[model samples]
Target: MYSSLRSLADDTFCLRLQRAARVWRKVSDEELSNLNLSEATTTPLWLINKLGEGLRQRTLAEHMGLEGQSLVRLLDQLESAGLVVRRDDPSDRRAKALYLTDAGRKLAEQAELVVRKIRARLLDGVPAEHLAIVDGVFDKIITAAID
Candidate 1:
């Protein structure tokens, strides 16, 4: 099936990206489900871990492209699960800084492991140069889209 309105090239990249994301999420979820975590849940942990100290809710929401309320809800869930904590920022009186508990940090590391394994599995037969080319192409696509 194809769109009558646009060329195949117009939709093919988007379709492939969407499908790839779905496949990655599905496999990641399967692995994380045992720990009651999905790709969605793991994302915040990953971001927090990456950002290290002084990560704020406002900044995190911006990174995730989520509204403040949505991020707060997700954070609430994580907090309740004893994975994360928010404290008054030392530098900024109004901002709340996010810190991962030992459990949260551990989960973030586990999530990274799961992602790396999945990536290796999916690209096992692909050449390193080919992967690099694909990465470069996607980088261009992202830059163009953002601009």
Candidate 2:
């Protein structure tokens, strides 16, 4: 039966977390596919929506933890899809600013709804107190990893 829970140890938490992340990503990918989007495009789209027009490509790349060329490739795809645009930065003639097209803005709204649904499903039955603790733990882990 499901007797392995009896033998679960504290040290296995990280392994469990990794498995959970993988599963979540799989589910998210599947859900996003219905909208003709993938996980790769979700964050950047959301960021563009949140940061508004005139967001620099370099700034978005930094926030996304992606290299310049990598971000450019993703942006290229978005631009080709007509979901985003790259305008010349007025203050910096050499740099490009990121902006969502009208279509991009509509997709961003849909993305937000999808994200809300996913979060609700994922957090279902999880107590708020427990989630707060988990959030704090994640912050600590991220800070430790960065340092």
TM-score (all chains, Cα) for each model: 0.83, 0.83
Give each prediction's root-mean-square deviation over alpha carbons. 2.7, 4.2
Clashing pairs in 1: none
Per-residue lDDT over 81-143 for candidate 2, one digit per residue giving the tens place of the 0 to 100 score: 999999999999999999999999999889878878988999999999999999999889877
Q: Could you tell me the lDDT of residue 113 within candidate 2?
A: 86
Candidate 1's residue-wise lDDT over 102-129, tens digit each?
Answer: 9999988988888788789888999999
Model 1 regions lying over 4 Å from their true place:
1-6
Over 4 Å off, model 2: 1-11
Alpha carbon lDDT at 86, candidate 1: 97
- The worst-scoring run of ten residues by lDDT in candidate 1 lies at 1-10
Judged by whole-model lDDT over C-alpha atoms, candidate 1 comes out at 0.89
Candidate 1: RMSD to truth: 2.7
